[model samples]
Target: MPAYEFPDRLNGNAVNAGDPQHRKNLADVLALLHVGGPQNRAELTRRSGLNRSTIARLVGEMVNLDLVRESEPRETGVVGRPSPVVQANDGIVAVCVNPDVDAIAIGLVGLGGKIISRVRHKTRRVPSVDKMISIVSKVVQSSLAKLDDECRIVAMGIAVPGIVRVDQGVVEFAPHLGWRDEPVAQLMEERLGYATFVANDANLGTIAERLYGTAAGKTDVIYLNGSRSGIGGGVIVNDRPLSGVHGFGAELGHTSVARAGLACYCGRRGCLETEVSLSRLLDIMGEASIDPDDLGPFVVASKDRRLRKEVDRQLDVLSVAISNFISIFNPEIVVLAGFLGELLEVNPERLLERVTSNSFHQLSADVELVRAGLRSQHLLIGAAELAFSPLLNDPISFAQLKA
Candidate 1:
């Protein structure tokens, strides 16, 4: 796919707060380029509602700071002269890492949401924090070594499938991975010599969806991602991920779906994750081991009557949880990702029927149920967005920091 310009700006406003207008202007311009693609000075002025002089000054400053570039004017085939196109500088790249229960994926993502390179290490045994750090650092170093002289690694973003303390770059808890309170970002920065940010994988997934996926241009969205280990949830209210003070607000999997169902790893009974997790489904199908990549085929090939019944039962339970979420959030879009996406792809009509029938008429009628747009790469792209966020908000300060 052609790389489109869409950077996650959900965290943009937090940076450069001392001079709000300057930060806002820079963020606005960057967001415009990210969403609308390259634009000329005239187009930017018209779209941003800023005067031509201000647009010119901002564009010039961005170009000088190496945050943006001005391409030669392209013919419009109109009566007027061609306008010089302005776009985000592709030389700036971010190192993105996503550490999950089963694997670690590292990649180099450029400013305009392009994945330049990626490597994945899958392990049968869960990896420790130290093991993950070593693997990720090596991959990042190798990726960086391959970059051309003009390319610069600005920052690194880590997406963990757990409760994250965003400010501290700490993984508060990841039940599936058996991790807790790990200072991941700090360790990465110390080891890799780059500024690092860490966040919950599903939270970042929602940001990816809003900025580049099916939920792009939509205001309210709820995203649910399922994997072999468990489920993670994210909520976007007015385009911002609803990260609570501790950045652990949207733990949707822990939400109770069954009052007397199976016990959850988090000590909860009948949690959404307990009922719909890929492991549970695989177990129901009599599988001894779980392969995250082979889930869809396993389900499709299963002809056991007991397995089919269990699948339908799980769907029924999942529908109840989804219905409750719809009543509570009333999101414009509900995105089912990963294994959930596969489930929806195979049985969208059945899943939709269950959810809509269980939900309130007015609320469920307008909500669009869709599969995730980005597959395995959602969290990685979201991590890159986190790394690119500060520069997008204030290119001048970022340039100074680099110097």
Candidate 2:
């Protein structure tokens, strides 16, 4: 519930590429603060594996940078000292942008990993990337203006629904957005005047769950976003998303289930996206003479039945694909996020049953199929986390910031 409770430790303001000893001491202090919450000088020294003198010196610097703060004293019975607490500061704010189908969401996230402000702009009929970036920049600028200029706008994380070159800051392709080799980060930085990070929207969603949501601490996990555009996936191994050699690690939508099936945007036939995407599902229903999205107010208004059936079919296909993933990756958790995340909440047991039935017995035995705790905000939160994470490292400075 409190901020700074994400998967990995914070970066940028916490740890920098400084003297090894200084960084180690800072890391110790951070480890203590993260695990035990607020602690005084003496408590920090004891838990951080650092001496009292080292803690005193390091904490003084942190205080000056507004990265850490002192708290009131707490008394222990029969104790001669009432130790004052030193806590990690949660004032620093970062911006997160998620460019999705319906709209672009911008969120102001604090160092403690809590969202402080959020705004959404409709994509409208013409969802140009330029328009989306402009809107996002305005929202971020407005949010930052409210805080101190020294508020450490550490990083800006963006989630795009396309193939991204993480190190290159290039979007190789985005069929839905009609984008190719677009320098999204450069465009955003040009508009906002801060470093920007771009990642696959679905991958970011997976990171969102792995860092702050239900999949925390899991060694291997799969995050799936089953939306109308497509079903995207982000695969995590040892707490890191597998970006692959070319940054296209998990393209779940393009994976083919039926060898000779529906034509996909990728020039492939019978890809999973063609069958499981909401748009495709609607088409399927249309062919079946079942206007589930149109008829049945409960089916349309609530639309549980229609969605459930479609999700079931998708899950069946997912089961086969996931079964292969499990056999290969052997992940501990396979998280279903995105629009289907809401649906899973309504029929968890049923969905889990199908997934379990389709997965390998040995692999499915322990694998958990769960819905994401974070909803539409998953990608947004992931972006903030991506930027702020590097800042939270101890003895933090600009050098330790990631690209």
Candidate 3:
């Protein structure tokens, strides 16, 4: 409901701002405000293990850098004293782009995980790599032109539905979009002149959930979503994305679920995407696409025996994959999005039952299956996280604020 909330634990081993440690101190305080919502200096002092004087100085520096702002504390009946609250400045923005099979979504996201503005460009056909880039450029330029001079655009992040060499910002493969070894971020950075980053859409989704969605404050999480193109997902372990050494790991969509099912575009049989498809559900619904809000109601209100049976059947197959992930990852929560979310919405108990029975470690760990909290905006918000990474990691350098 809120744009962002407090994490279970603040990350970063930031000590007191002693000489070189000032950067870490600034990073730590900023991280608290950015990830854990607004808080007073007292709370920051407790969490960061910094003295009041150090925290006051750090917060003051960030305020000067325009990274955050302080507001008079709200009056609650039980409060002894209301200290000023430090919150991220929404004026600092990042350009987020996500190009899927049917549409290219561009959003301007501010600090504190706020979605300032969003627009989608629908396409009749799957646009090529070059075509998508062109569209993104147009949308970004037009959007930036409308912003006032105070609106600081620091970076741009693009989420691709493929294996990305995140360190290099190159897309190794995107079967849905028919791409390979595309230097998408580099091109955009050269054209737009802002720092750019590229990442796997599902990986971004996983991070977004941890940042502000259902998995917020969670350490280990599993996120899977079924869209028209296919299923894509990501995993989080110990609060870090399990992106593997090459950033090609955690390709959850292609995880083989069947010994021999339908062949997948990735040269595999019975891939999760091939087996559990959104198009199958949409075809049965007799619509090209269903509204995010209407999907559950339509499934619930409809008494069609065929639809009910199909939903159950897909759930049966999907449960096997979910259980497998639970056993392996031992995640606290498993997030299902898009059509898969519709499955959970229709019969949460039934799906949970199936997943529990199939999971090897079900008896050992309490795993909760939930829907994506950010819903349709998860991907865009996820892209925003990547764009915000640089600043979150090093507030001093990102803002060019020296000690």
RMSD per model, one decimal: 4.0, 5.6, 4.6
- Tens-place lDDT per residue, model 1, 86-187, is 998877999998776667888888888778887778766787888888898778778767889999998999888888777777888888888888988888
Query: Which rank order by TM-score, best down to worst?
Result: 1, 3, 2
lDDT of 3 by residue, 1-403 (tens): 1222212111132333346678868877887787788888888999889999999899998898889999998665655877788899888899998887877888999888889888878877887877887888898789889887878888888888888877778899888888889998888877778778888888788778887889988888899977766888888787777766665778788889996899999888999888788777777878766545467789899888888888888888999999888878888999998678888999988888888878775442588799999887888888887887767766766676322
User: What would the C-alpha RMSD of candidate 1 be, to one decimal place?
Assistant: 4.0
Q: lDDT per prediction?
A: 0.80, 0.69, 0.80
Per-residue C-alpha lDDT of model 2 across residues 288-380, encoded as one tens digit per residue: 222112222323355456665776676576666767777778899988776556545655666677767777788779888777877666777
**TM-score on alpha carbons, each prediction:** 0.89, 0.81, 0.89
Quote model 2's TM-score: 0.81
Best of the two (1, 2) by TM-score: 1
In candidate 3, which residue ranges exceed 4 Å CA deviation? 1-18, 77-81, 145-149, 290-294, 301-304, 361-365, 401-403
* Candidate 1 whole-model C-alpha lDDT, 0 to 1: 0.80
